[model samples]
Target: MNKRNFLVTGASLAAVALLSTACSTTGGASGDPAAQRAAIDSAVESSLARLFQENSNAKELVASAKGVLVFPNFVSAGFIVGGASGTGALRKGGKSTAHFRMTEASVGLLAGAQSQGVFILFMTQEALNSFEASRGWTAGVDGSITFVNVGAGVNVSTQTAQQPIIGFALTNGGLMGNLSLNGSKISPLTFN
Candidate 1:
């Protein structure tokens, strides 16, 4: 085979391998609805604790938010073609109202894997209602999400907090940088 052809073939194989591993690790539970619910609940609890600790203002946001979508562990891995997936629960008034899954695909200058917890706060009742009404909600297009940067202290003023939606992404440990949730799609999941 020619050198160019050989290189392309090798790249394709590597991409496939990376995607397979990512899927297996991040895929939601396939059986046992009770067990899956337990896991998601635990993750949401721990993740929210961490967020509240890191960003004190998050407490206020959570209290004021009409609903919150928490993805405890979203994993992303790629080589050329990349995707991310995670399972989570939506909570209203401190109780889980529904389960949801987040998935996204991208092609760009990126490679490697990352695992992070994401919490999206729907600031307005209308925003939360619109999201719950949709069969599949795509980020950025459906609504603009502002990712709060906690590094600068908890200064999320009332004006900024008034945005329709806000998000926070936290990584446990990984080589990934500049996390983006632009094209991610979130849909409700019914566990059987």
Candidate 2:
């Protein structure tokens, strides 16, 4: 190849790399901690309102919430079929501290990562005890927790909801893989 052509190609590759790096860093810092919290709060409020308007169960879900925690980013993965989850939280504030985590295995043409998801940990002594005490709890098995899809408008009414549960609405980060293979990891909770 000619010297001029080689130089142009090199510059083009460099530009592409720089652009890729920038896009990868888009959600970094998410902004000031306080601002992010407020952002989460606002997003949750708006999302829940929309959910409530569309689904009566969502209204009851909000009514049933004592306290809510909107993670705005919960990561997941499988293999071929993968997507991120992002949303808000609902909880009743009375505990000194709270902790929760979820891990899953899936089959089918599954692959990639759910890099963004919201985990609503219902803050209550009863729920806390159940989660902490149990070794494992599936989404629709042991408890009455509900997950609101970013697009799917669905919820369980408080009258039907056995116990107050935390709710989450994940909105961003759909392309992701496993943490061990792709260096992804779960983020910890941020208190107010």
Best by TM-score: 1
**Whole-model Cα lDDT per candidate?**
0.79, 0.43
Model 2 C-alpha lDDT per residue in residues 1-192, reported as the tens digit of each score? 999878655654554443344322213436565554455555445545554454465455545555454443344443332333332333344222332333333334643444444435453557655544555444555555544433344433344354445444433432121222122122333533
Clashing pairs counted in every model: 0, 36
Question: Which residue pairs clash in candidate 1?
Answer: none
Looking at candidate 2, what is the lDDT of residue 190? 51
- In the range 1-192, model 1's lDDT, one tens digit per residue, is 999878655765676676566544324644788777877887898888887777777888898999999998887776666678888899999988888889888777767877798889999999998999899999989987887766425587667688899888877641122456888999887676
What TM-score would candidate 1 get against the native? 0.86
Q: Where is the poorest 10-residue window by lDDT in model 1?
A: 171-180
